[model samples]
Target: KISNEITQFTFPFDNDVWSIPVHRDNSYYESTYKKSPMSKTDTINTPATFETKDKLFVAIHEAALTDFASMTLLKAKGNQYKSDLVPWRDGVKVYAQTPFNTPWRTIIVGTKPGDLVTSTLMLNLNEPSKIEDTSWIEPSKYIGIWWGMHLETFTWGQGPKHGATTANTKRYIDFAAEHGLDGVLVEGWNVGWDGDWTADGSSFSFTKPYSDFDLDEITSYAKKKNVRLIGHHETAGAAKHYESQLEEAFKLYNSKGVNAVKTGYVNKYLDKKEWHDGQYGVRHYRKVVETAAKYKIMIDNHEPVKGTGLQRTYPNLMTQEGARGQEYNAWSNDGGNTPEYLNTILFTRMLAGPLDYTPGNFGFDYKLPQGAKVQTTLAAQLALYVVLFSPLQMASDLPENYVGKPEFKFIKEVPCIWADTKPLDSKIGGYNTIARKDWNSENWYLGAITNDEARD
Candidate 1:
């Protein structure tokens, strides 16, 4: 049951629907009322959103964050949009005792569409902070060898062009020190990235480094340079194997003064059978977060379960990527994300919590290996730093790409975390403008974006 006060605010897909297009993401426009998405048995994934004439309805799962990644499917039926909450979609036998609890199936009612950007309902529903001392949970901007790997200028595995190496990492650390960046992220520094890292991550070692990366020396060098070393733990969706190494692995990074980790689960399923968004995967992800907290380590999760304000409870659970973000524009199967993608999520998935979108790739002129091309303009890349919210923002281009460029200046000046934020104006999947005040300074930054056809 919903609060009586919000009952009038409820306007589902009835005849009140407009001729507007519905978005699953920016690229999703096939299912507008013009041709009814309800014609088929299409089930929308959890933590999704839909736009009405004047309201924003957020279909979220597990509002009170728990150890259950239940899938909440939204659909338009019976002249109104309805939601069906299920425990697991993978057809697994869920064996739970009667005394056990269930996940919270919920929907956030926005008085207006802008509430998706402003309301913290999901975070508010969660418990208070678990970490009493949050002084170490600080936010900052970073650069990495990541983009080059995506562009194929460098490889993840070792060779002449391997992105993660002792010299390459030190240069990135030096760059972070020179600029105002607080940390450097180095992926593929560990072994097991060679040969099909995604198919089977059983060989990945959390405590050991490749012969060329030199973890001890690099971490020590970063410490001397007044920069932190953000660690990378790419599981390739091998959840069980990674789970076995969690305690010892995090303990290793903690000892090295590495306080933050970017964990990846880049597979369709966990352990070749477990759904990454099911109860089994849910327990594993939470275990990683709580385990990292014991070592004073923060987490940035990619290929993640939909965030539900758990960061408010565990401030160390900083950011995650559950949407099809900037990287898709770099290289994906279907060209790249459409121009309207970022603007779309601003009012949809973003309602859940912080997202590590890894923005600011100013490589407009650079040639991609495939016929792939960046779909957005150079200006939007700059605007993303402000429009997209994340405490741990990434300058996700090669170090060389930013050299001596005018747009790079805005990226350098933007703050990752905000003291306050306000959405000035927005049209779902069309355009958006937002202003944010830096948490540590008096300065405020404003950003605006439009769909691909917004301007010439």
Candidate 2:
């Protein structure tokens, strides 16, 4: 039964409303028709004015009230689920995958009741309201380098030619300091590993050095060069125990001057109750945030909680790898970094919040051509710095690939975080164009990419 309890609003853009409607199933989209309130009388009364859509997590509007006449039919709100509306905006939007005792408020757009519009919707079960914070980690001045396990997996003591080796790692550190990168990230630094690829081997070292690679020396050396060392804690197959040791780990590492840590629980996909953890995969995540905040050390999550836009509450939650990332190079026979895949992410995964899916691969083709493998063209990689939003952005490619490449100038120009983010245009699974402004500068950065055919 369709309930008559209606939520109405006008549009909020200068152009026709280009909105992504949120449904009870947690799905969202870019509506084909402009959405707006309809009167019992269909008369062109006034000039085009703005409207707003106030929902828990989204708010947007349509300024040019052009094709909305056909989209007036809305699904009935019932005890089963509630509907949601969001208007497109050019700024950061917050989402929460699980409930917490933090303050999150909804953004109301448009001036009048009939002027509001909604773009996306979700199942709000004790759902916390979405609110904006005046304080956000501005990413304009910082550049980040991320070195993780998969690449480390390829090194195999064969030197830099294979992948990430000790010599290559040092070169990366030097390159960051020399080329003006503000921070460096090293994942897979935690203990427990088998020599030949045991999934969860017991023979690992947390405090000991790895085959002559000293953690203390790396941290100290990076510090001497004025570069920040980003730490990683890979609790392989151990989520419950990871939290118990948080304080001890933080104290020990912070004493060594490590300011940030990328904690991971990639075991979710593994078939085990211990691996599933609990509640939207955020029960343990909240604990980590609380503990990390107590220590005054920031965090970047990998294979952590799916961003329900919690960065608003816990600013230290930098970025996450919830989707298939660059590591697909090693596993997938044919890398699946397709244009459609990229397009699907914006409408799906990114709607939740910032992703640490590191972009920028200098080479492409590992097996067939035997060269460094990259997913897209260099320009597409460059555009990712603009399109894919994250607070701590990464230049994941090897230093040697970028040593003589002049195109890195563009990569260097991309801002990590922005004061405003505009979903300029989108075709859901086809293509999307986005524009972002530096948090401090007046300049704007735009990134646009297409799916297979490029029709959208």
Candidate 3:
């Protein structure tokens, strides 16, 4: 499994340990496992393939240069990287195409006030076998929304959406299709969400929906409207039952034309070691990949596992929310992420795969009408369509919120998967730039960001 084409970076210090800042606001976009494509701008050069370690190293260096340059320009204008102020930003986050544990690790160093530090990172995947040359699906043409309109049907914090009538669900689906959406997600559609957490965990029934929601009718109607009905499975609480019932679930979903599903492992339960299958977040995730492949159904996992280039092995494994996502709205007031963290994550958490960070909640900014639920600005959300990579991307914000906003074009233009990806710059938690091109089209998509204070 020795890849002569892999890059290697030797630090001057011992044990390859280094610290970098991770801004909390950047956490707004949780890393998902989806990807979109962009036309090649030819703005930067890329290596066709890393044929040797030297080439890989060269690629990283080149990417680092580009990232630094972009951030440097931004910093000159007075934008300071926020991650430098945080203590936890200095840690190793791996995103490899194969399962690779870097032989090296580092202790992060805090940046001086008003300063930006760039850290180099190594990219490797544990399973090179998973890498695929074929495009899983065209990037950008198709867009999706996650967890469906359930939150609209019922308030997230107000307990169950018992009042989520079938009429309400249809109305939401109709909106997506009317507005040219490709798919809609429906989380919390099972019995567990409504007080049957125990028995329902093992009793996974793809054919069934909560008493109030008519899944079959909804999916059928969605198809007629040319919109997809994305199914969901919350399994961390009931792994054993889910494993046993998986085939049936897939078969039922297949029968119903459910091409996509969002699986989740939310809570950390005791004595349920098998739920994670005695593997770290990444290893257990491989099992899901294998299972989904058999059924030919695409999957988007949340709160359960981390990704490391498995999309190449299983194209259907669309996206995963490995990092803090919009769900932060329900939890804390930390605001979740910042520009510094956004720039750093690309080099660390997303180096190996597509992120389903569920971008696009335009309603959160403090500047919006008083009492609005959104937390960030419309421009930032627009940036995510470029910054976050995913084949199964989500327009997580409510349809009503986007009603007359023309900025929605950014989402319309973002590609979900790419034919090839080139890391233009690599600075683990400082600044990073990625250039990905659609396999079919000459067009390319480029995303670059930096930690606090920018780089040069």
Which one wins on TM-score?
Answer: 1
lDDT of 1: 0.74
Q: Rate the local accuracy (lDDT) of all candidates.
A: 0.74, 0.50, 0.49
lDDT for each residue of candidate 3 in 132-153, tens digit (9 for 90 to 100): 4334333322333332332353
**Best of the candidates, lDDT:** 1
Worst 10 residues of 1 by lDDT: 1-10
- lDDT rank order: 1, 2, 3
Write one digit per residue (lDDT tens) for candidate 1, span 1-456.
111110111343432221222223321122222212333325555455544444445444347646543544444445344443333444542445566554555666665557667776677778899999999898879998788887778898978899889998999999989887899999999889998888899989998898998999999999999999999999988888998999999999999999999999877777776666566767788889999999999999887766877888789999988777666666776666676666777776676678788888777776665545677778888888888888899998887788888778888888888889888887767888899998889999989899866453
Tell me the TM-score of model 1.
Answer: 0.89
What shift in Å separates residue 336 of candidate 3 from its native position after superposition? 2.0
| Local accuracy of candidate 2 as per-residue lDDT tens digits, 268-310 | 3311232221232345666676576666566777665345445
